[model samples]
Target: MADDRHQTPASGPAPNTPDVVELPDVTRRDLVARLMKIGAVSLAMALAGGGAVTTLTTAIAAESTKSERKYRYGMVIDTRRCVGCEACVVACKQENKTPPGVYYTVVLENGFGERPDDRPLFLTKPCFHCEHPPCVPVCPVGATFKRKQDGIVVVDYDRCIGCRYCLVACPYQARYSDFGENYPAIEHDTPWADVPSPEYKQFRQRAEGKSPIGNARKCTFCLHLQDENGRYDQAAGRWPACAKTCTGKAIHFGDLNDPDSEVSRLLRERQAIRLKEELGTEPNVYYLV
Candidate 1:
């Protein structure tokens, strides 16, 4: 029985092994702080990216507004003063080198008489150049578009797909499709002119076969003349060839948006009327009765 107390402790397991050590509350707090910092960084990046996108969107909107609201050129024809002289019509043909039966402009006959009570009146009709142009939408391709600055409707011949949808849509019948007819009779007289111009591009020498024949064309308010240096100078305050060449000075072209312009003022002072007002085309072309 010697030292039996020391040898009797051998048991199945120890009683005080100390439960698994618990993490400190401070460690949990530090972990949460790190997570918050990462979340804040991510949120800041998202906000910055959103701000950049909003800035770009605002800039694009401003540019679009500027382009759409810049300018709108128009005409005011004095029907009372027109003398039915085809000078403007002939000038347009000769200058632009249009073929027979393809007139950019025409003098419309209203009545037949020589005296005031029985005098024949004339109305020269050209492209009305409507503000909300119908021709632009109907075009199969975007060949025709109104200038964002001046509101002048123009045709991009090269881009036109010869769909002819614009021609049918126009109420004024202003559009003309080229037929590729050449002057086989006139010796040395090409159906197309050789003048290489941005505004008055004569599609002559047109690849021996290719011509604007398949494209839609119309009056551009004589933009070709306006492009030439000093053309407006020679015309004496005129902006279009038709208006410049009119001996009676019946046609007037100017910025309708400018109330101070001569055409604008005339339109205001006179009983101005547009062709086919029932259709509501808002034709820029005005007539003074």
Candidate 2:
């Protein structure tokens, strides 16, 4: 029996010259497959990151625009039309239910004194709500401050410690210490005693030794009358009691920023003057002398 078998080839490629080896043929399909394996996920992640950045930028821009729409809410009192009636004062008391020594507004009877003209001059004075408020920084506690949304100086009865520093710091005499004195009706425990004051929208009932009693009190420009957007509706009577009840039509309240508003028109038409502008307080309250 003969054994027929294939013999092994022992000779290999030359070591001196590099052997040329054939590789698999590559095509566009191969490139596409490779891209799908790695580049696809990278592209998707990039698109998602770009979308998130766009959304975040849009939201921040909207918030910045809203914050810039700050309102310098203030008053323009036409002194020429004021008749010294003090209706505004009485109306303020009725609205805020201010106690003794806690007058939110007052009329300067001889503010202008005897002028050359025969007409008597009476200036209605309220919390000026100065741009650089003196009372805010003077507060030992953070009891009083001005709102950035609306330039209305506010006193936090909860935070006040009866220090009265804010009262002294106010150059406009806008602040006062509430000593908890009440009217005869409250002292007698009559039906009016239960009446609640709608200050800062707190609606707190009058009581002795309470928060506001020991706190610094001042005019808030009747801020409680404003809407959520800090707007006052004159037609609907949702306005400051003083301005609403002014028989002389002297008090004009509106956003000073709005050129279309009546207060803006008045300020443009007339020469307005503020009390103690030299003090650098920059009072929002203006008087048409």
Candidate 3:
């Protein structure tokens, strides 16, 4: 008998030949949704065949009934109250123990005009944690994500490949790439070098070739201070270091979703503005100009 594997019938083309099929153009969001659906179906079949029907059903039910948003954590800064003292900047450095040139928050000064008589506007800027964060989708490794519980955008340093895609995607220039630069205290092997940063509830000591050393970093709203319920207690001193330490009490942080919350109330009464609103990033951080 002749081997059939290599044999081709008298036809227009080979049997195993693939035909080019033109697919419809899909937007990124549609592509992602389709991929998620494919994954979910695959997982469901695997679990069902493995006699884990209950688990699969429960998971599907939970996903189907997932809430749109539990909280919208944000900040409202009163520019009038800001003294440009940079106390918030200092507090953030001390709290996060960030390396030199890797500040999660910064104070920017803008003059009203080129004239000397123009008054300078002080802006304390941090990660906006946008409702539709461009940074999250651009990260190829899925290292950065917006938390479903509180809407805080965070980075998973372990998964980050340091591609810096998020940095470029961010309109606010909020994300920073860690180049492993250390402060003088850590560089000189001083006693302060032993202190670890309690970032993301991970007390990581600064060292060469570490996860955060090469990962993209950003502000997390001091989420590490939140309790297991994902709630910050200002009375317990569990608030964000920058907001807590603002010398002029310029920064207001709270759950914007709650209408009664301080941030929401401020938004209702004060004339607030967000940066680059035309981009439609929907930044959580608002400035009371």
Which candidate tops lDDT?
Answer: 3
Q: Per-residue lDDT tens digits of candidate 2, residues 1-289?
A: 0111122222432111212333245454443343344334333344344533333333333223223546777899998899999999999998999988788999997686765776788899989987668887776656677766776778868767888888888888888888889889889999888989989889999776677888889898888888877787899988888888999999999887677888889998999999888986778899997
TM-score for each prediction?
A: 0.67, 0.76, 0.75
- Runs of candidate 2 with Cα error greater than 4 angstroms are 1-69
Give the CA lDDT, 0 to 100, for residue 169 in model 3: 95
- lDDT for each of the candidates? 0.64, 0.74, 0.78
| Model 2, global lDDT | 0.74
Give the lDDT of residue 5 in candidate 1.
16
| Candidate 2 local Cα displacement, residue 288, angstroms | 0.4
Which regions of candidate 3 are displaced past 4 Å?
Answer: 1-67, 111-117
Query: Residue by residue across 51-74, what tens digits does model 1's lDDT show?
Result: 343333333333233234445567
What shift in Å separates residue 52 of candidate 1 from its native position after superposition? 39
